[model samples]
Target: MAIAVAATRQVLADSYKTLSGASTVWVSLHTGDPGSTGTAEASGGSYARVQGTWTSGSGGSLSMAELTFNAPSGSFSYAGLWSAATDGTFYDKCALAPSITLGSAGTIKVTPSFSVS
Candidate 1:
């Protein structure tokens, strides 16, 4: 089988200002049951991180650079904390590293840089 490097577009809200190249950081989403209670993707859960870059400005597209899956043992810390909601704190559904460093690109679509496992 062949592995493909791809990702979907992640848009930025007006409040976020905009998405830039290497400016934003996000994690990958895995396929499987979230498991039992407290088995969320970033909360005491397992996930992977895919590094990439955005070519354009704050509203263009994302170009992946690399990917890594580093699952923590217990507890979890998302990129940013939600103002009102705690569950929506994480930026990426699947995560390992701290965050992706968006480049000069402001905002654009995003995708995986390589084959993520």
Candidate 2:
């Protein structure tokens, strides 16, 4: 199974929950039509609600990379969720509405089983 933990408002701590095998799941947003483009959508199009959980992995936590996908290469607005529990998902500890601007570079380090990748 997948897991999530909250750190802050604009960051999300996700865990692939990988034990012996790597987990793979699709991410969806609740805005645009997730059509024609399969799971991922084209630019500007609204996305479906962000769904699915990544199993807790080595880097069990990750601050949803802000603006990592922003630029001429992958320009788009994205929403994120934050949780507090190492495997919290039942409720949202915090919510990241939507961000599309160029974000400042920073880092968040998770210990024991997680870190910035």
Candidate 3:
């Protein structure tokens, strides 16, 4: 038998709210799972992590403001959240439903969201 631990709605909401309070969240592009250390992070051709602004947590979830990376060249399949622009901390990551492939002159836009259930 599995022991099921359930959290109340308020607890879920609060958890997300706390996450939204991170000081400087950075959004990183990846070719695959970022792993524990944010491996496979995209680089070169103007590719750089962008600072992310998050909406206040609500109803157990929070959303990142849309982020745009200009002139980034890569084939990205995932996005990772970090504490700084470079090497602060790896919080989490998620897969991009369709993935993004950019050439040297184009841009990539993403709006990521988080939730606690």
Candidate 4:
């Protein structure tokens, strides 16, 4: 479950006050390529993080976005949200189970939530 953002964790652990709205959110794709350690955030490349249309629901606790790319060029098994349009800190991540192999064109949707639980 890709729930808490890194900033949220920092806030919980160190009382940091950084926060972001849906406008700064973006999604990145990954293939889990061999010799690639999935530790740092994704960057600009074939599997770069792209911005999407964002909407708020459930009193700002829920965020939904869809990324429509002109031509799908890679295979993606994981996805995540970043705090900036490019090269920003990753906020949340989710595993695309069964993986998603893109065709010539398609869209990928992601919904990340925050709650008081």
Candidate 5:
């Protein structure tokens, strides 16, 4: 499937003002493609938030963040950013490279970057 590369209009607006300062940000893994809607939540099969360090990116070039799933479960082809740590609005979507498969061991890292030009 083709990758859906779009951030929410609200996210784009808030991102410039106070999105970076939002508390309890989270990144979730998704097997379902973002499609045209470009929004989704992790409340179904094999979907869960990765437990890792979420380093918010700095600078006016790009508002980005990195997530390293210490013990990511299942498999996913896409990733998303949420405002709340759990059960929040999906602000952005990203299709992973080569997909991510979590087995018995190892870690999964996903770096989602945002830029406006």
Candidate 6:
């Protein structure tokens, strides 16, 4: 049986609260699918995960504040959400609509939105 809409909304709301309440939530840039272990994370040339702030979930949806990354010279195809700046917990990942490519001295800014139905 499928989950009820109200139940789904509750689940998403609870999840949003948990994720946003974490001491720090990090947004990571990825060259490919981060996979289960968050592999393929971007590295080198000032690449680092940026901390994210999230808006309150409503109707089973929420959005992350804009994240700015001083990315290295490469192509990024995905983004991952983590529990910490370094190696902590890997929450989830999503593919970029139009993957990002940077030459030298580039910056990528993204505002991620999430929803569950």
Q: Give the candidate number with the greatest TM-score.
A: 6
Q: Number of the top candidate by lDDT? A: 6
TM-score of each: 0.28, 0.22, 0.79, 0.51, 0.55, 0.86
| Total clashing pairs for each candidate | 28, 24, 0, 0, 0, 0
Q: Rate residue 18 of model 3 by lDDT.
A: 51
List the candidates ranked by TM-score, beginning with the highest: 6, 3, 5, 4, 1, 2
CA lDDT scores, all candidates in order: 0.32, 0.28, 0.74, 0.50, 0.54, 0.82
Better of 1 and 5 by TM-score: 5
lDDT of predicted model 4: 0.50
Query: What are the per-residue Cα lDDT tens digits for candidate 4 across 1-117?
Result: 543565544334222112354344666665553123334333333345666544433322434444643325456677666666666666566676777666634555544443322
Positional deviation of residue 34's Cα in model 4 after best superposition, in angstroms: 12
Error of 2 at 67 (Å): 8.1
109: Cα error in model 1, Å: 19
Question: Which stretches of model 1 miss by more than 4 angstroms?
Answer: 1-22, 28-39, 42-53, 57-60, 71-88, 91-117
Q: What are the per-residue Cα lDDT tens digits for candidate 6 across 1-117?
A: 534686677576667647646524788999998888899999998889998866656667677778899999999999998888899888888899899999875899999877666
Query: Sorted by lDDT, highest first, which candidate order results?
Result: 6, 3, 5, 4, 1, 2
- Evaluate candidate 2 by giving its C-alpha RMSD to the native, one decimal: 12.6
For residues 1-117, could you state the per-residue lDDT of candidate 1 as single tens digits? 322322212232222322322344444332232333223443223344333333332332333444344444433322221211223333333342544332322221234422121
- As a whole number from 0 to 100, the lDDT of residue 6 in candidate 3 is 36
Candidate 3: which pairs clash? none
What does the lDDT come to for candidate 2? 0.28
Higher-scoring candidate on TM-score, 1 or 3? 3
Candidate 2 per-residue C-alpha lDDT over 45-104 given as tens digits, one digit per residue, 9 for 90 to 100: 222233234534333353232222212323233222223212223221121234233233
Query: Where does candidate 5 clash, by residue pair?
Result: none
lDDT of 3 at 105: 54
